[model samples]
Target: MIIAVIGAGYVGLITALCLAKIGKSVICFDMQTDKIESLKNGIAPFLEPGLPELLQEATNSGKVKFTSNINDLKDSSIAFVCVGTPNDPKTGSSDLSYLYSAIESLENVLSQSSTIVIKSTVPIGTGEDIYKKYPKKLSFASCPEFLREGSAIYDFMNPERIIIGTRNDQDKSRIIDIFGYFKDKAEFVHTNVTTAEMIKYAANSFLAMKVGFINEMARLCDSFDANIKDVSLGIGLDSRIGKAFLNPGPGFGGSCFPKDVKALSTTAQNHAKELPIINNILVSNQMHKEYLADFIVKIAQKYNQNNIGILGVTFKANTDDMRDSASLTILPMLKSKGLNAIIYDPAYTNSKPKELDNFNFVNNLQGVLDSTKIIVVLTEWSEFKGLNFNSDAIIIDFRNIYCISDMQKQNIKYYNLGRLNEGAN
Candidate 1:
């Protein structure tokens, strides 16, 4: 089967490479000539574990090709739209301009029997709207992707479920055949386009709510002199509430959770409905970010520590994505209060965020640790564990990366969310 993936971003590149690995000939198209050229040379633009090697292998096999021209999509029987739907700054709704442009470009070269799959996360009814506007010969489906950034390759190869959203039986059959490689490995869900779109939004929003709920619980645990680690384990052991986003941290911030939660709330408001839980999740998450900043400042003041060290600036470990990361908000808040921070991340040693252009970033963890009196573990990177610590340095662990007893045994001042005595000097 010949497949075309639009937009050479994380989703498009991974999808094209994985499809080629599964024996399908794929041509990936992106408007960015530089990104296309980089891919052509077997170099990935972003940091994803196991992606560069996979790209090299696919390129060597000659099963996948990268191009900047829309004309390259002519031979593809199916084209997957993987463009981004970033949140609108003014309205907090998903900006579909990129998706629309991709559709327009695909429409120009679409064959009579070609299927256009919407793999991007979009609002409900978007698929129907596209199908209505496009020619009858072209088919549409809403097959939203659920791959995480760091483990995208593994997720793509071992998806839990494959959703095919189409109205026509012929379209469903065609999509099934396209994904026949995963027929036995994953569950195939056939549904209408709107429901499939709703599933993506609802799934992400629910996970965001879970993170928010646990963070709120962590605050209560702090007040009542309880430990969230124990609380999570006790509740997780129950069959009804399985543990998965229960671990407390600064807050949940990433490419999908924050934007999708806001988009879902906006969608509900557009329909003249109320979503109190979703609204509270957003507010609570914002407050949590501020709370962490204030907590760090309070600790620094208590110990008379002026210099701060930050570990892990990326949203999560194993990926270099800094979109909506907690460090983005927390570090700026601290800087505004005249506190200085030296930051370090394994992936972002060379790159500086535009927002944090003036901030200090060290190339190694030891440099950050040496320059600051207070060490803040912002992102949960595995490399931060078992590191040598200065006895005088105060450690504020947002991700609970270390045990409270261990920190106490070393006689180091350590603080973590949801643990009692964290605020005590």
Candidate 2:
């Protein structure tokens, strides 16, 4: 099959590479010529584990290609619109200008009728709207991606469920054949386009709510002299609320959850419906970002040291994507209150942040740990577990990366979310 994925961002990049790996000829198109050139030379613009290797293999095998021209989709069997739907700067609603442009451009370039698949996380009824406006009678499906950043390739190869949102049986059969590369390893879910779009929002919003719920509980645990880790474990064991996304962190921020949740709320409001609880989850997550800064500030004052160190800066480990990262928000809050900070992320080298001036990016973890009086474990990178700590240094573990058994023997004051300490909660 000849598949054309529009937009070489994370979603489009992964989709193209994965499809190529599965013996399909894929052309990943992007707006930037530089990005296309980079991919042609087997260099990924962003950091994702296993993507560069797969890109090299696919490019060598002549199964995957990158292009800046939409005309390349002329002979394609499927054109997946994987472009980003960023939120408007003024309004929180989804900005569909980029999405509509891709659709119109592909419409002009398409030589024959083809099925259009939406891999982007868009609002409900967007597929129907596009179907109405399409120049030709092109079949459409809303097959949203549920792949996480660090584990996109693995998730793609082993998906939990493959959803095909088309009411027509013929359309569903075509979509199923496209997905048959996975064989019986992936389950199929048949639904309407609007319902499929809503599934993406509902799934992400529910995960966001789970994180917010735990963070709120952590706050109360701090006051009542309770350990939130134990509370989370006890609750998670109920079988109804499985233990995942329950661990408290600074907040949930990446390419998907934050934007999708807000977009969902905005979509609901447009229909004269209310999602007060989901709205609260989004607002509460912002507050959680501040908690990391507050914890670092208090630790700095306690140790009487103005220097602070950060372990990881990415939104999550294994991926070097920094969009909407909690560290971006927390680091500035610490620096504003008179604290010198140095950061070290395994996936990142020495790139100075444009907005933050008082921050220093170091090459090695030891370089960051040696100079600062307190170390903040921002993202739970696996290598951070090997850092040597000073007795006087304060440790603020946001992601609960440390081994609980070893923490008991350490002389440094360790403060973690959901884990109650000895003194006054």
Candidate 3:
């Protein structure tokens, strides 16, 4: 089967490469000529583990093709719309401009009875709207992607559930057949297009809420001189609470959680419904960012230092994505307070956050530590786990990468979230 994936960004590239790995011929379409050329050379535009190897193998086997032309999708029976739906700054809603452009570009090129899958995270009713605008012979399905940024390849191969949202039975059957490669790997859920769209928003918002709730608890733990790690362990053992998203960190910041939570809240407001929990989640997360920034400022004042070292800038470990990262907010807050920061990340390869255009970014971990007085671990990168700290240097760990007992044994002054007494050893 010939499958075409549009918008060769993270989701589009991963989807195209993974599908090709399953022995299906795939044509990946993108507007960026450079990105297409990079993919054709087996070079991924972003840093994702296991993707380059799979892409190279797929290209070498003649199973995958990358092109910037929309006409390249003419022979594809199934075209997945994996374009981005970034949050609109003005409306605080998901911007579907890219999605619309992708669809319009392929309007004349796609086969008469082709099946179009909406893999992008979008507002509800988008699939229905597309179905209404397109030809009746063309089938539309809302199969929202649930792949995590760092572990996208693994998630694609081993999804928990596969959702196929379409009104037509034939379309559903054909879509199922397309994903028949994963029949035993995942459970297939069939639903209407709108419901499928809502599922993505609902899942992301709920997960954001969980992260917010735990961060709130971490704050309380700090106040009460209690340990948050033990609390998380206790609650997570209940089976109902689950261990996922329970770890306390510098709030949730990624491509999905922040944008999806805001989009869901905005959607609720448009319907004349109030979502206090959702609204509070956003507020709490923002407050937590400020709180962490303030904590850094206080530490700098106590240590009589103006320079601070930041260990990681990416929102989370394993990916170089810095979208909405805590560093973006915290670093600006610190700068406003007349504090200097030297930042380093293992994944920092020429991709600096636009917000920190003038900020100092170091390529080596030792460079960040040698020039700064205090170390602040923002993203929990694996290399940071084996780091040797200076005994006199104060370490503020937002991700809780090190244990209090270990830091105390080394007589290292450390502060971590959900720990008591600000980690004074």
Candidate 4:
């Protein structure tokens, strides 16, 4: 069957490429001429592992094609709308403009009775609202994506569960057949559209809570002189509290967590209810970033160093996304305190972002090592794992990439997230 994948952004591109991988004849359509041109040349706009290779293979096999013209999607029977639903700044609810716009664009070219699957994360009740508007023109299904940024390809191929939210049995079966390879291993969850939408919001908010809870524990560990890593291990072994999303990092900053958490909270509030726990997740995460900034300032003051070296800037490693990274918050705080930041991220070797236009950007890791004696490890990239530093450097390992034991042997002073034995020989 010829399937049309809408939008070519991060999730859209991943969806289109993975759909092609599953032997579907995919026509991936986007409005941007530049993005379509790049895809035609096998160049993905964003850095995702295994995506470029997959794109090349799929295009070479004549299974997929990218196009700027919407009419290219004329013959497609199934249209998967993978457009973005970013949170609206004013309402803290999702801006459905992109979702609505994608539908309007599809309405122009999609064949009558074509099935439209929403792969984007949207607010609850969106399905019912859409069905009321386009009942005869199309068939609707809510099949939200749960792919992570770095491991998107693997997650798509081996999903833990594939939720197909539709009342129609034929619609469900046909959609399930699109991902037929997953039936052997993945659970096929059947739900109404509203329930499926709630599931996405619930899952993302819960993961965000785990991150906020751990960071809060890490702060308590700081006060009590305890090791959070050991505490994490202790709680994670209970089986109820699995060791996922338990890593203590700067903050939860990606496209999904921050946006979904806020959108869910706003949704609850709209229903005349209060979600204190969900509300506190965002509050706690923001406080965590500010707390880390204050801690770093105190460290810089103790070391008497105005020039601080920043190791990484991306939210996490392996992808070049900086949507809601804590670096965006923490770096500006340091600059406001008159501290000079010398930042180096492997992703930004070509050029730095305009948000960080004021801070000095170094082309290499060695540039950061040479310019400052005080260093702060922000994002834990793979390249920073085995880095060797010499001389008397004071390092604050936020992501805890460096070993405290090894730091002492090298005569470098190091601090990490509540590891009590960081000082001893």
lDDT of each: 0.89, 0.84, 0.88, 0.88
Which residue window of length 10 is worst by lDDT in model 3?
Answer: 416-425
For candidate 1, the per-residue lDDT at 138 reads: 79
**Deviation in Å, model 4, residue 239 alpha carbon:** 1.1
Error (Å) of candidate 3 at residue 283 is 1.0
Q: Estimate each model's TM-score.
A: 0.98, 0.95, 0.97, 0.97
Q: Could you give candidate 4's per-residue lDDT for residues 1-425 as a string of tens digits? A: 89999999887888888888888889998889999999899887988888889889888888899999999898988899998899899999999998998898887788886888898999998978887886455778889899898888898888999999985777788898898888888899999888989999999999999999999998888877698899999999889999888889899898899999999999999998888999899999999999889888888887788999999998989888989988999999999999999999988997997778888999999999988988899999988887788578888888977777788888888877767634312
Tens digits of per-residue lDDT, candidate 1, 1-425, equal 68999998889999999999998899999999999999988789999999989999999999999999999788888899999999998998999999989999888897888889999999999999988886654788889999998999999999999988998998899888878999888999999999999999999999888889889989888788799999998998887888887899888888999999999999899999998998778899999999889988899889888789999888888988888888888998999988999989898788777767888888899998788879999888899998879887789998988877888888889888988755743
Candidate 3 on 1-425: residue-level lDDT in tens? 68999988879999988888888888999999999888888788988888779888889989889999888789888899999899999999999999989888777888777888999999988888887886644778889899998999999989999989998997798889878999998999999999999999999999999999999999889788699989999999999899998998988998999999999999999999998988788899999999889988988888889999999888898898878887888899999999998988888745566768888998898898788769999999898996788777788989998988888998988888988855331
Clashing pairs in 3: none
- After aligning candidate 3 to the native by TM-score, how far in Å is the CA of 108 from where it should be? 1.3
User: How displaced is residue 104 in candidate 2, in Å?
Assistant: 1.0
Query: Could you tell me the lDDT of residue 152 within candidate 2?
Result: 85
Clashes of 1: 0
Model 1 residue pairs with clashes:
none
On a 0 to 100 scale, what is the lDDT of residue 273 in model 4?
A: 89
Model 2 stretches astray by more than 4 angstroms: 353-358, 422-425
